[model samples]
Target: MIETSEQGDVAVLTMSRGPVNALDLELLTAFPGALSDVAGAAAVVLTGAGRCFSAGVDLKRIVDGGPSYVAEFLPALSTAMLALFDHPRPVVAAVNGHALAGGCVLAAACDVRVMSGGTIGVTELAAGVPFPTVPMEIMRHAAGSAVDRLVLTAEKLPREEAYRIGLVDELTDDLVPAALARANALAAAPAEVYALAKQQLRAPAHERIAARRERDDPGVAELWSASATQERLRGFLSRLAAR
Candidate 1:
């Protein structure tokens, strides 16, 4: 699910699930471990194989597996996301293509996001699911004023618009090189100091997540498992297939 390679001092982790690299339970469960595998690198560059960074949660899996699967999946999703968010080393997102819903949240959790050609946004509402506390907090921290439109409208903004809205730190066609350069630049700082400063900057969001996750996550999972939500997701899948 993840392919790890070394590019000089930077660890490059590529999501290789293929097609759109949708986040399923297996992929989510493997992600944190992949991060652990690269702990020795000075920095990390995360991207996806083929044309997509990720297309977000495997809603088809959710619709097919029902509530039991949802109960198991949500926790894994949170774990993977938090692992990236709290990684001690700098992490850069090399968003090569579509990053929607959970995929957008994953990119948002990174230290710097460099994009080439991609559309990015959160479309959880359109899927008839509410954001889990972790994703909500990350989006709040990254998107600022753009969060409302992203969450509520569920529009996938093109690369230029995404850059304008501050969703991506840099826009360049030389994705991996630009992302590697930025990651290296950030890694130049004292590792311990950089990690500590990052933790401090993200402390507010972390605190909010710690405070509300226990209460909020279960409700979010329950909603995702609700029959109406499943039906909506099925409809969404159909629409996607039609397209």
Candidate 2:
């Protein structure tokens, strides 16, 4: 599900689950281990194969597997996201294409996000699910004032608009190169200092996650498993199929 390569001191981690790189339980479970495997690298660049960074959770899997699956999936989702969010080394998101919902949250977890040509937003609400604590906190930290609009409206903003709203740090046709350069620049800093600063800056979000996750995540999972939410998910999938 993850393809790892080296670019000098920077480790390049690509999400390679084909088609849309949808976040299934396996993919989510594998992600943190991939991050751990790249620990020797000074920095990391996370991108996706094909035209999508990721399209978010696999709704078909959810609909087919029902509550049992959702119960397992929610924790994996939070763990994977938190792994990326809490990685001590500098991590840059090379958003090669569409990053929606969990995918957008994955990108937001990075220290910097560089996009070439794709929409990026949190569309969890549109998918008939509420944001789990990890993603919600990450988005709130990365997106600043735009979080409310992105979360509540569930609009996938185009690259330029995403930049304007602070979701994207840079927009470039040369996505990997730009992202690598940024990662390299960040890696040049004293590792401990950079890590400490990053931790300090992100401390509030982490605190929020710590305080709220235990209380919030179970409720979120229950909602996802609720019949009404499943029905809405089915309707959302039908709409996608029609398109």
Candidate 3:
């Protein structure tokens, strides 16, 4: 479930999907609507329930549900990512712990990212999953050119390194408190002005990737459901099971 609370002008959205807060079909489907509901808040703080922020999508679910699941899941995932990226309000990520794959993309999509513990990374390639164009664009915008290397290598960076590479905007010992403070500060700006400025800053990314998202998303989903990708997933699952 997604939990919401108001801290002064700052609204908080907590990912409470349990344990690792895996971004499964349900969470992906509900995420955008949840954010839309809190759009009226001056600023938003997004975080997870426990130690870890999110472990990304549940590969097992895709493996079990097969092609139909991949088709629906891919679009939902893309929509949720785009929602966070395009949200008019200043959205901050209180990254309390490890945020891998889709989770990392979520943090990157936010206007500001404040991380406290664990690590953050794009592990799509490592897991033998293909990256859709939208996520690649989001990460590139967040972390700059270094993002290309990380995506290719699946290197999980510690908080210091993440901050260094611009994957996170700030790092502090207290995640929520720091993020809430940042959100409160940003909320002080005039609503329309801030929204417009934020949108302007994000336009380049949106414009550049417009055609690609329309093309890549469905294609990647089909690729994920392909026999070869399934074989790779089987190997990935086997490694997970062994662990």
Candidate 4:
């Protein structure tokens, strides 16, 4: 589900699940662990292979016996997200296509995001997939004024608008190279200082995510189990298939 390769001081983490790189339990567990194995890298560049960066969480998994998965998966997902967000080295998102909901949050958690040939937003509310605490924080931190528009409307902004709203730091024809260049620049900072600066910079969001961890995860999971959301999830899967 996750593939890692090293290029000099930068580590490239590619999300390679078929069709679109949808987040599932296995990916949730493996992504963060992969980072640990590549701890030597000064910076990490995360991207998805094939067409998309990621469509977001695997709705099939969420709707199929979703409650059980959410019970465990939500925590795991949050842990992985927070781990990437709090990683010692700079993390850059190289988004090649539509990055929605959890995928957008994953990008948001990173130090920088470069995207092209696609849209990006947090569409979880519209998709009937509930948001975990950490991902929500990522959106608020990264999107700012765009949050209300994105969450309430679930609109996937175009590349230019996405950049205008701060959804992405760079919008260019070249994704990985732009992201890697940014990562290389960011990687110049002293590792310890960079880590601490990032922790401090993200402290508010991190605290909120941690604080809401106990309270919000279950509610989100329960909503996933609800008939309405399950029906919505099914619809989402169908739409994805049709596209």
Best of the candidates, lDDT:
2
Query: Candidate 2's error at 169, in angstroms?
Result: 0.6
How does model 1 score by TM-score? Answer: 0.98
Q: What tens digits encode model 2's per-residue C-alpha lDDT throughout 76-147?
A: 998999899889999999999999999999999999999998799889988889988999999999998888
Evaluate residue 242 in candidate 3 and report its C-alpha lDDT on the 0 to 100 scale.
100
Q: Worst 10-residue stretch by lDDT in candidate 3?
A: 211-220
Ranking by TM-score: 2, 1, 3, 4
Instruction: Tell me the lDDT of model 3 at 162.
Output: 86
Model 4: lDDT equals: 0.85
lDDT of 4 at 146: 79
RMSD of each: 0.8, 0.7, 1.1, 1.4
> Least lDDT summed over 10 consecutive residues: which range in candidate 1?
214-223
Off by over 4 Å in 3: none
Model 2, global lDDT: 0.94
Q: What's the distance in Å from true for residue 133, model 4?
A: 0.9
TM-score for candidate 3, please give it.
Answer: 0.96
Tens digit of lDDT per residue, candidate 3, span 71-174?
88888888889988888888999999999999999999998999999889999999888988888889888888788788999998999998887778898998
| Residue pairs whose backbone atoms clash in candidate 1 | none
Positional deviation of 53 in candidate 4, in angstroms?
Answer: 0.4
